[model samples]
Target: MITGASSGIGAAAARLFAAQGAAVVLMARREERLRALAAELTASGARALAVPGDVASEADAAHAVKVAVTEFGGLDCAFNNAGYATAGTPLHETDAAVYERTMDVNVRGVWNCMRHQIPAMVSRGGGSIVNTSSVAGTRATGASAAYVAAKHAVIGLTRAAAAEYGERGVRVNALVVGSTRTEMMEQVLRTAPELEDRFAADAIQKRMAAPVEVARAAAWLCGDGSSFVTGAAVPVDGGATAT
Candidate 1:
């Protein structure tokens, strides 16, 4: 199961997981885009389903997992990747509504997902789950204060889940995602084009990551290859956190 599966790293991870022979349930708010991606993957011989809903809603999150188990038999992994990005204007300057909206999607969304997903995974004996955070998760990053706070909260949720379920075969981890060539990034650049270079220069790679690059990292964490890694924040960033 992949939230935010309509685009960016979520979309890329959906393709990679299907290619690797896992049935995928695509979850996001955009029904058209999710269904279109599902059709393309299904036509290519992979079992894929689209579940459209807001991740912030507990009932919706539960229903997405239900679809995965009912349609595909079981869900062995999940990428809780639905989130949005915005500039950190100043604490006082940030609109309260915008801040609340950010927290709803980025923080509460993950809370809703894990509460439902863990029970399903426990039922099947074990599974892997990944949450999306960002460089802002660890530092100020010039993003809005709310975004930074919400992301940091995600890491707390990831670690807490991992600790609670590690003995039960469930692995929970967070991706410290960096600036990537995502639609969100493009939107940010529209107002501040220099941010493109600023983001790249913050990383050792000196370039923005393609969404697929981050997707690959997420896939690895959810796969058996990272069997021993849990309760940790994995940096999919290009060494930005390293600096």
Candidate 2:
């Protein structure tokens, strides 16, 4: 199952997993987009389900998992990719509403999913979870204070969950994603054209990642290939964190 599967990295991951023969359960606020993607997957003879809802609500998160389990039989892997990205601004100057919403979607949303997903995995004997974090989780420059703080909290949750659940057969990890060419970034650039150059300058590759690039990393973490990797904050950011 993947949250935020309506577009960008989540969409790419859904496609990739379905292509690899995994039935995908996609959740996002964009019902139309989610349905379209599911139809596309279904047309290709892959199993897909669309569950539209905000990840921040516990009820919504629980419903998403329930749908996945009911339709797909059991939850094997989940990519907790639903989140909000606020623009870069000073801590004091940022709007309180945006700050709170950022925490609600980015931090609390992941928490809600994990709270339910972990137990389901436990019941099934094991599963893998990959939470989409960002370079902001490790550094302070890419976004506002709230976004950075929420992502940092994500990494903390990943580590704590990994330690707590590893012996229980569930693995949890976070992806330290860099700048990716997603709708959210496009919106940021539309509002602040200067961000384009700022993002390009931060990475050694001098370019933002495609959604597929991040999706591939997430797929590996979710699959048995990375069976020994847990509590890891894998960087799918083109050397952004290295510099």
Candidate 3:
């Protein structure tokens, strides 16, 4: 199952997973987009189910998981990729609502999904979970303080959950993603055109990562190819964290 599967990294991951013969459950709040993608996958003779709902809501998260389990039989892997980014701003100048919204979706939403997904996976013996985190989780300048704080919490959650569930046969990991070319990043560039150069300059590769690049990393963590890897924050960041 993949959340935020309507676009960007989530959508790319869904397509790749489907192509590789995994029956995918796509979740996103955008019904039209989700349905369109699901149709495309179906046309290619791949199994796909689109569940439209906000990850921020506990009920929605639960429902999405239920749909996956019921429709696809059981979930072997989940990418809790739903998240949001508030406009970059200084801590003092940011609105409280913006901070709350960001945390609700980026942090608490993942927590909610895991609360349900872990049990579902446990019932089936074992599973892998990959949460979407960002370079902001480790660096200071990638996003606003609230976003950074929430991403840091995501990394913490990934580690704690990994340790707690590793013995129970669940593998939990995080992706320390770098700047990627997505609608969100494009919007940021439109609003603050200078950020493009700044982002490019920060990464050793001096360019934004393609969404498929991150999607490939996510697939690795979900598959038996990474059987022994867990509690890892694998960087798909083009050496941004190395510097």
lDDT of 1 by residue, 1-243 (tens): 999999988899999999999899999999999999999999999999999999989999999999988987888899999997787578998888988889999999999999989999999999999999999999988777999999999999999999999999999999999989988788878867867778999899998899999989888998889999999998988999997
Query: How many angstroms is residue 56 displaced in model 2 relative to the true structure, after the best TM-score fit?
Result: 0.6
**Model 3 pairs in collision:** none
Provide the overall lDDT of each model, using Cα atoms, as 2-decimal numbers: 0.92, 0.94, 0.93
lDDT, ranked from best to worst: 2, 3, 1
Off by over 4 Å in 2: none
TM-score of 2: 0.98
lDDT for predicted candidate 1 compared with the true structure: 0.92
Instruction: Compare candidates 2 and 3 on lDDT and give the better one.
Output: 2
Off by over 4 Å in 3: none
